[model samples]
Target: MTNLLSTSNQEEFGLNVLIIDDNEQITKMISSFLDMSNYECTVVNDGKEGLDLIKTNQYDSIILDLAMPEFDGYEILDALQRENPSYLSKIIVLTASNVPIENIQKFKELGISSCLQKPVDIDQLLSKIIDSSV
Candidate 1:
């Protein structure tokens, strides 16, 4: 478990969080952490299902993975950019791939809150979640 002692935020609870990742372990770990921290979490390991959920429900924060087999994160992002641009503020990109600076800049320009590399510290991820939801 992450050392929650390092987080400075006030007590928080019941934030609706959606985690969309292809990796089961990653999603499980995050969902477990969020649940332990009193967040309402929904996890989808399939990119298509994740996109569907995004279209149908609003979330406090969205943790998105860049790589998936069928319907990748970029496609979801593009769809959101066209249909619901405001949701961009709630998006936090989590990827292991080495994204070029220009693409990272593009994600920033598109209003993505954070583009964190994989193996991210759970505290840092929580911080990004807190900051972006605000």
Candidate 2:
């Protein structure tokens, strides 16, 4: 079967992606890789900023980290889902936390599109984005 997650099809797609992560290196890396694609990326180092950005803009996807000060990814997700369910479908959690089965269930309940564990696998991240767009 053909792998539908290939980036070859992404040329026709134009997306605005928000990446929320506390790790500077990871954020830069993810943004760099994503920028090389057809997507526009805006990265924030904390949940509060991420939340604020989400409030002000419409993003095709959100790559959120589970751990952060003040507000966590879950909190942001909850707030976004409460305020706008349409955006909820675009969220993808990028976390290093050992997300439990129950938590995963909760993520699903909150309408998270996908959850990626860190240290981020670039190929997997790209694949997820491609799959999501498709």
Candidate 3:
């Protein structure tokens, strides 16, 4: 298990994190890591299903992928922002896309929490979560 869980008051916070990615392997890896901690995580393989889950439940955070089948993360973001403004602050973009600088800037302007590239660093992700929770 990751060390961050032992140091943080994760149980008190009751973090609910949603991961939206089409890649099953990536999703499993992320879920396993999160489950080892105090995070209550839900993974969805399709963007449409991810968006539906988001609308149906409340989450402390969301890790979104740029590309997926049925619907893309961008569309899901737009829809969520329109329906639930508060969720805007909780969304984090986690994708393998080589996005442009301008696009990254736009995401920041839209109030996304953070953007994590592909081959995500476990340490970095844990740090972000711990920091955000605080």
Candidate 4:
């Protein structure tokens, strides 16, 4: 893990974040913003690829989208829950779907740090990443 010191003497650190979204444009946009913020961002366009990366690597934070053709976000979450429950705390769900409140609550119960509906405010995502990394 890389340690990126904050601008202040308090010494906050930036994290390595993984972004799993099928939308290439969205991934590119988020990756650009995160790169500017000093967080190491790795993006994948397929859910299966994202899950494979998660299994093989360690990430301080994850920005996940709920919808995908194969191996959707839910599957990724389930795998993480079964294999690495602790990692769930680092997740930030970013979905464009109009999911029910109950499902949102379910995700929260599974230990996701936050669930954001797209088009997510980049500033808010940055803030959440900073907070979670600490």
Q: Which candidate's TM-score is highest?
A: 1
Candidate 3 has a TM-score of 0.87
lDDT of 1 at 70: 91
Compute each candidate's TM-score over C-alphas. 0.91, 0.85, 0.87, 0.87
The collision pairs in model 4 are none
Model 3 / residue 77 / CA error / Å: 1.3
lDDT by residue (tens digit), candidate 2, 1-134: 33333657776766788889888998998787677765789999988989999899877778889888788887887787788777766877878899999988877886668887887667687666656544
Ranking by lDDT: 1, 4, 3, 2
For candidate 1, write residues 11-41 as lDDT tens digits.
4446899999999999999999788777889
Better of 2 and 3 by TM-score: 3
lDDT of each: 0.89, 0.79, 0.81, 0.82
lDDT: which is higher, 2 or 4? 4
Residue 46 lDDT in model 4? 90
> Tens digit of lDDT per residue, candidate 3, span 20-82?
999999889888978877678899999999888888997878888998867999899889778
Models sorted by TM-score, best on top? 1, 3, 4, 2
Once fitted onto the true fold, the runs of candidate 1 whose alpha carbons sit more than 4 angstroms away are 1-11
- Identify the superior model by lDDT, candidate 2 or candidate 3: 3
On a 0 to 100 scale, what is the lDDT of residue 79 in model 2? 86
RMSD of each: 2.3, 3.1, 2.2, 4.2
lDDT tens per residue, model 4, 1-134:
22223345222345799999999999998888667656688999899899889888989889899889888998999988999888888889899998789988888888789888887766687767766565
> Cα lDDT for residue 5, model 3?
65
